[model samples]
Target: MTNPKSEPEMAGMETDQTITPVIMSGGAGTRLWPASQGDHPKQLLSLIGERTLIQDTALRLRGRATGFAFTDPLIVCNESQLVPIRTQLADIGQTAWFMTEPCPRNTAPCALMAALEIAGREPDALMLLAPADHYIRDEAAFHQAIGRAVPAARSGHIVTFGITPTAPETGYGYIEAAEPLDAHASRVAAFHEKPDFETARRYLASGNMFWNAGIFLCRPDVLIAEMQALREDIFKACQTTFAASPKTKDTRALDAALFAACPAQSIDYAVMEKTTKAAIVEADIGWSDIGSWRALRDLAAATDGNAVRGNVLALESKDNLIYTDGPLVAALGVDNLAIVVHEGQILVAAMDRVQDVKTIVEALKNKS
Candidate 1:
């Protein structure tokens, strides 16, 4: 493991004009299912290239024109993932702060904890909330978009990055921008949850809706205020958790009972849906959450109508995604199918039906 000891410290970046990268790595990423297990989720796996998704997300903040605004990312993840998070950070020579969670209370509490932490440390700090597992092909455009959002974030509005919909994707929620705030920004008209195929198609045709990218930027105080006003219980939960400065001995393992006691809700539900301070920024940076095997297959480039990963071997497969680790995989006459073998577990499902693969995992768990 390479030590980032010599790297310049960014401890006080909030004062020196830097954006705090708050990464959320708590979820099990169940959509990817068997391939992304509870013990080792998708964020820890090298689902894309040589680097894990978490690694990619942490490094994406570097080399920006925001004047060292992106540094020492504060990673909010589950307790089980601390070692891997540290290993990946050390492996890539990136400095980070770990905000560990003992239990999963969904994203609202997770993000609220981060906000409270930052607010306590630096009330004026602008933090960017991002998911660890996402695919963004156009790095330049992504950086440009980040730069564009800083101004809005600084202006006291909760900014959300909305990816311009290329197709009718039923997997992601949609955000409707009411009017153009500028060339790069707009006012959020409303938030829409994931829709059916026909509704998604209509959204695509409207050209006013963008896929909710789960990326947000805002000042810590603003988020706290908005959250407190929107859902007082969530705000109070985060306050109680932070009031005692949740123990850092075990990588800041949050109080499990307290976290579970907090209501399970997403940030969108707890705050964004009710806040009038919401702003949307649309960009075509080639983004996807890579939530499912089918989504991963769509993101992966196809060669001869097949997308293969890890130790895979295909003979007559077409339009298939084969992802396995260590095990040698062989496919014959398979089309539009996903085959994933990981740690003695195999998942085989039609590409279109990959969304239902979680049922198999649930069944497997029942047997265990």
Candidate 2:
């Protein structure tokens, strides 16, 4: 193993300006089953590139090449993920602080807790809220998007990064960019929920819509204010949990009972949809949330039409996703399906039905 001591420190940022990266890492990742379990989620696994998804996410803002400066990340995740996340980041020589959630309360409360925590300390800090399981291929474009959003964010706009829709993707929500705030940013006209295939097609044809990338850049004050106004109950509950809980070393645990009582909602639903100050920066970066097996398969799509890993042998398979953990995955004349072999589980489902994989996890939970 190479010494992590040689890894670069957080550098290249101007002295006066700094961005605090608050990474939301609390995803169960059930759509990517067998390989992604409750204990070990997809963010910790190297599904695509050499690095784990969370590692890729962490370094997205920090780099000598991009010159994007960031403080050590404040990671919010379940307690079970701490050890693996710690070990993973250490391998890359990146140091981060962990905020452990007492229970899973979704992203709205997670974002609220982080915004409040950071606001308590640095009142004027700029925070870039990013998901831990996205894949962005273009680093330069991603950095440029952040650069464009910073000015808007500092001007008190809650700037959400929007991805230019490559296809009519029904899996993501859409943000209709109404008017240009500038050459790079736009004022959000309306936030559209996930559309059906027909609606998504119309959105793509309109040329005014962008995929809601779930990435945001805002000051702590701005975020907290929006949360308070839009979701007072969540704000109060998270505040109570924060006040009641204590920090030990680099970890802060939320009050489980208090937090569990908080309303479950996404940050988009709670704030961005209702906020008048919502702004958007168009990012052409190759981005995918990789929420399903089909998405992951598309990443490694080969000339032979197979996206495979480990000990996979496809005799005549085409347009199929075949994966193996510790066993052999053999496919013959299969097409448009996902086949996964784990230590004790074998998953085979149609590519179209891959999104329903979460039902399997739900069934297991009900049985227990």
Candidate 3:
């Protein structure tokens, strides 16, 4: 593995300053099961175009020299996924400094490890923390939003990107923000979990809420301080784990022992909910978490109100969404239904009821 320190020219980063991207890529993506499996999660899936989600994230940093500055990312991924990680990065003709988790210790530990690494390079280094599997259709707008948030990060605020909600989505957490920090940013009021349909409708009507985009920008020192105050146990574990692990290509050897010792917790529960420095940026640039097969179908839908992919044969099918990479899918006179044909599994359900696919997965587990 080449030294990350030697890749200064990639981002046009200054010798005196550094900003690392921290990608959190360790979710099973259960909602997108069948296609997204435990062995190969959603981030590794090539859902959009030729590039996998992980590669798209890594390549997001590669473009014409933008004034908004950033360094190469430090990817925090699971031990079992190192091979896919390597292959994905190689496919993009880029390499990221990887810190493999010994176990699935969640985003809190992941972010903390990233902060520890970033702190070593520049004590006040900024970090762009994001998931690898999210979709943003507007890259120019995303870059513009990042430019707006950079000053907020510099001023020691943990800035989170909140998507302007297009619908009453009960699946996403909401961020209530009031008053703009500048022209484009806002001070976060609170974070709320997924609500019921009626409550989601109210949130949508209020116009003060944004879908939690799970994208954060902050300085390493500020995050360290916040984690130290809000989640000391996680902070200490991360410090110890980073100290013991060698910064090399072969990080799989120590992953199990280290992860087993660390506690599992999401960043929201571990730090964001408890931090007073929490702030949010409200923007709508066509963002989606792609949480379910339903969402994937909706995203691929054409203007005529139908989405079809793979070996799909539809007859008299209107307003139906079909996704199949395996098995010949034949749809007849179905509307508002999602059909997923893969492997030996065939999922055919009402689009509105697709969220209950997890229940079926649970029942299948019981049968095993």
Candidate 4:
């Protein structure tokens, strides 16, 4: 509720810059269904490597880098996820602060609530807002990217990491980089919504566009001021909910009624698109949101063009992704498909249509 304690006081941070990593872990990940469910979302799963996605995210931001010291990660998620998230973090020998949402109000309200909490404690400290489910392979490059953005962020600019697009990705939004503010950072020219195939190709060919990585860095007070100016309704609702909530030494569960009253909007729509202080830092850190089965397949594909996990036998399959946790999957001459079996559910869809997997999840929900 109130400014509890600064990072130096709470976590014993010692550096010129103290960054509190806010790991946003609230998405249900319906697009990665069967394996990724509401109660146990993709962030809790070890989809990429040995550790869970959230665990990896926490570990990625841990320890001190060259120019900054990171406090323990602050995880934000639904109340139902608190126990599991705490357990997961503990498994990695990591301690974290948590804020539990009573209901989902998307990232805008989530960011505002986190900024309010952090600003109350440390107004000068920067908050690095990142999703728990992204897959970034290059930790060194990521750290470098953060270092490049810190000066701009400290100068009162809200910086978003822009991933160098390897392909024309229609699934993610694009950021048009305007003039170079520095060698590593750029002024944002415009924010474009997800484009069609032709438009995506154009974006790729332009050489001045990058995929919106959804990772952001800014001072908590700066973010609060921007939100207050742009979305006062959301700002007031989150402030009311945050103040009304009860807090422990490390956790706060938001008031359901108040949180539900807050409008649902992403940080992009609410603040970044309209803010004059917006900046973009180029990040070639092998970032992937792992948004769908196709994305996972692309990340893990073998030279033979198949991403096979568990007991899968593909005789002549090419460009097919098969994952199983229970039984063995045997595919014969299937191409460009995703075949996944987990728990008691199975999903078989063309890789081209993997983005439509949410529709199947909705259908199943209605059937239930």
Candidate 5:
């Protein structure tokens, strides 16, 4: 992987680029079952720090970086989540432009709609598409990486920030970097799907592979043109929805009929993986998607190999995550497990199988 440029190396490379952060907050987060539900997802929960994930994301974009200026974040979320999200942002003293999806249509449509909206106002401005629920420990490093990506983005290349892999993590997709675009960026060679354990090890061993962080930077016009050329159906549908949506000073409520007619697909499958203008900037920002209970456990674990929160007793338990938001949870002689108690519901699963928690949620839905 290409090494991130040092602060001095990135000095004097400043530009007048205006970056609009588009925070995607429409995920269901079913893997975090009892604590995260349809109306209240992980982004709304204060899992990592005192601030909720969406609030943290917005706070990160509050000030300007070295090379660029930031406008208020544009949040893309569902109608049901609007009030809580607004309240959370208000609690943090941050304001945003909200785009409420009428229904779930995935990231491709979301990206298209964001691009259309931003392009309408300022076509030359850059849009940083970021997930509302990711954790980045080093905010300075993240901003530096964004600075590194700015040159390529202004040149009409769609830049994706790639996390330098620290281990053989099988949870995330991988991106292979080809030749160097400059001192700080590389041409994307290929995008690989999530691999098995053995393949993950191989990717870790390969120095050129990086974890896909799912964050993108590009000019709004560039993204709009690419979507129109590559995924015309999604582009047209989102355009129709955007045009029909009623706009207020701070919110855009999409038309339900127009939005529901759009197809569901991620930006990766719809455009990013297929775009020829893809570029990668290596970022060692201590990033984590926090996709499952095991991931949260790993992030919050203490010196005793246990991550405990609320009223919980973990006796003779090593490498276990015990959390309670409702009642006292007592555990004895359990290792490599996740035990969560929230809102009168309980979950006990082996850590290795925690990724399958979404399946249990699906089963519960079927039973109802």
Candidate 6:
């Protein structure tokens, strides 16, 4: 806790003016149960490489070879996860300013809190909002996308990075690129909700649609203005909460009472859909939201076409996902199933129905 110039994308931000990577780390993997819970969410879990997803996020945006000198990242996370998150960052020797949510109120308020806080110092400084739980295998391409988006951000247009859809993914939302903003960016024609498989195939065939990666870049002023104009209640509430919060080494504690009053909404619903200055950058960054076990398994390097982790044995099993913590998970004659063993809880899901695991989680909650 050495006193720096400022904190939370602040502190060392005294001189340098660069796009700050604001990592949102709160979503509990409802679909990825047992392993991803309220206490230990998806971002904190090491589902990918040696580092946890959040750690990997920090490292990737660590001003490495991105061709941009990004400031130390700022993270918006949950209150229940603070200690473990701090320990993880400490273990990795990465320092970041953290803003803890009083409760889960979605990305609109989170964006507001970050925008207003960072804008106080540098109104023109670009802020790039990224989800912590996502996986991007192509680091270079990601940096390239950010570089392209920075110009639009600097021009006062709120920009979102749209992933080039490799397949017709019905699970993710689509962004239709209306007009070419430039060779690298485009004017967002329409934001399409998750569509049926036929519609998704049409989107893929059109070549004008990109998967919404939920990554946003804009100046704090632009976002502040948009929120004030469109979602004023959320803006006001977050402003009050941000102003009341006491900044600490690892956490900025928002006013719990006030934050709870803020409207729970995503940025898309709050501002993006309505904004006239919305722009998008087509990014091919090998991206995956990892929203389900099936997604994680799909991204994993498979053996005999089955994704198996930990003490796993598979015989005649193909295209299935098996994960175990302390038990020897054996699968025979099973295909496209997700079998996860954690502690005393066992989750067995059909790969196609993995997204509905949230339903199971809610049912279990209701039972207790």
TM per prediction: 0.92, 0.93, 0.89, 0.95, 0.95, 0.94
* Residue-by-residue lDDT tens digits, candidate 1, 313-358: 8887788989887889998887999888887978889999988888
lDDT values of the candidates? 0.81, 0.85, 0.77, 0.90, 0.89, 0.85
lDDT of model number 1? 0.81
Q: Alpha carbon lDDT of residue 38, candidate 1?
A: 81
Which 10 successive residues of model 1 have the least lDDT summed?
1-10
Q: Write the per-residue lDDT of candidate 5 for residues 90-116, one digit (tens) a residue.
A: 998998888999789999999989988
Q: How many backbone clashes are present in model 2?
A: 0
Query: Per-residue error at 237 for model 5, in Å?
Result: 0.9
- Which of the numbered candidates is closest to the native, going by highest lDDT? 4
Model 2 TM-score on a 0 to 1 scale: 0.93
RMSDs, each prediction? 6.2, 6.7, 5.0, 3.7, 4.7, 5.1
The residue-by-residue lDDT of candidate 3 on 1-368, one tens digit each, is: 11222123333543333457788888778777667776788899888777888888877755433445566677778878888898889877886777777578778888877777777765656788989898888888887777777666767678999898989999999999877777777788889999999999999999899899888988787788888887888777766767777765534233456657877898888888878778888777888888887787778777756788788888887778787887788888888887876667777788888777777777878999
Q: Rank the candidates by TM-score, best first.
A: 5, 4, 6, 2, 1, 3
Report the error of model 1 at residue 300, Å. 1.6
> Residue 128's C-alpha lDDT in candidate 5?
97
Q: Residue 32 in candidate 3 has what lDDT?
A: 71
Name the TM-score of candidate 3: 0.89
| lDDT, residue 338, candidate 2 | 94
Evaluate residue 153 in candidate 6 and report its C-alpha lDDT on the 0 to 100 scale.
Answer: 66
Residue 200, candidate 5: Cα error in Å is 1.0
Model 2 gets an lDDT of 0.85
Candidate 2, poorest ten consecutive residues by summed lDDT: 1-10
TM-score of candidate 4 relative to the true fold: 0.95
What are the clashing pairs of model 3? Answer: 102-255
